[model samples]
Target: MNAYDLVRGLHILAVIAWMAGMLFLPRLYAYDAEQNAKPEPLKSEMQALLRTWQTRLLRIILNPAMILALIFGVWLFWLRSGQGADWSFAHQPWMITKLIGVVLLFGWHGFLAGQRKKIAAGTSKYSGRFWRMTNEIPFVLAIIMVLSVTTEWTLR
Candidate 1:
């Protein structure tokens, strides 16, 4: 009904879209890595298919969703600050921890994008197992971020 509420809803929707891509792209990369075990011709074809999927997902969904989420999240933060929310919240231990988690989330996103660049250059070195292992990062970060926001728990 209000502007902040609408922006918050949109931010949640963007985050969901972005997180879905984050969860999926690494699995696709794992499959792409597995393609290395196939016959040469099949490997090339599968690599091409995977590259297309990666490009489309990044450009059409993931990048835009991330941008939207950041934009709206900053807006919400500013709105709260303007409405007299205490600036000291930023220094709270739980808030600091959540911000650290968010920074790591961005770093993880960059690492995955770098992997995609390597794939494009035919020089990726990471294995399917590695990707599978890293896939849990986003899920874990999401859980921590959600819990921090929902519970507003603080270190005493």
Candidate 2:
């Protein structure tokens, strides 16, 4: 239909891809951690495989999806602001709240990238349980962001 609709659709798809990658990556980390406690050729082989999986997912899908999602998300935010003529909508507390969640989500992504590096290098500092816990971050942020965008809490 419209350009906004198209951009929004693409943004949603990118988010799906990005979230899927985020969900799966930490499992890879957990698996890597498990493999690390093993011995010899199996350990090395599993580590190499997990490293390859993590790197490819990060560089090939996750990073690009994140960039696209950000671009489209920003575009949608700007679109909602209605050019430069209107500023009232942008001042909504819900908008600010949503943005904070987004910022935190991005920070989580950065943290994952660092973790990826450590896991790949076999120098990860945390346990598999740590990664398992961190995997819930996106879900929490998603809930907050969805509520912020969908409900008129500020308008009430």
Candidate 3:
């Protein structure tokens, strides 16, 4: 309807896209790690295919989606501020919480990228179990963020 509404929609869409890759990539890593125990050409073939998928997911989906989400999210925040929404941490603890969650998500994205590089380089020390456990990070963060926004959770 309005510009704020449009930006908010874009932000949500981008976040969904980002989350898809965030959730799926770790599973791919888990499979790749597990493949190390398999024999010969099968292991090599699976790793190569997984690596390709990882690279494309990161480059084509994750990176652009994250950047767009950040941009649109900031736009929404600016629009809200223009409409006199309180953004200060003291006045809007939920906003601060959401922002912190976003930062953590970004950090997780970076960590995954680093892990992908290590995996490609044949130097990753992480196990399939580790990757599987860590795959829940984004989902947990999303719950906190969504609740913060929907509840307007605050100290006051």
- The 10-residue segment with the lowest total lDDT in model 2: 80-89
Query: Candidate 3 regions off by >4 Å?
Result: 83-91
**Which parts of model 1 have CA positions greater than 4 angstroms off?**
83-85
Question: Model 1: per-residue lDDT, tens digit, 23-80?
Answer: 9999999999999999999999999999999989988988899899889988877776
Residues 1-156, model 2: lDDT tens digits: 987888889989999998888888888888888886798899999889889999999999889989999999988877766755676767788788888988997998899899888776667798888888888888888888888878847765
* lDDT per model vs. reference: 0.87, 0.85, 0.93
Report clashes for each candidate as comma-separated counts: 0, 0, 0
Better lDDT candidate (1, 3): 3
Q: How many residue-pair clashes does candidate 1 contain?
A: 0
Off by over 4 Å in 2: none
Clashing pairs in 2: none
lDDT, residue 105, model 2:
79
RMSD to the hidden true structure, all candidates: 1.5, 1.3, 1.7
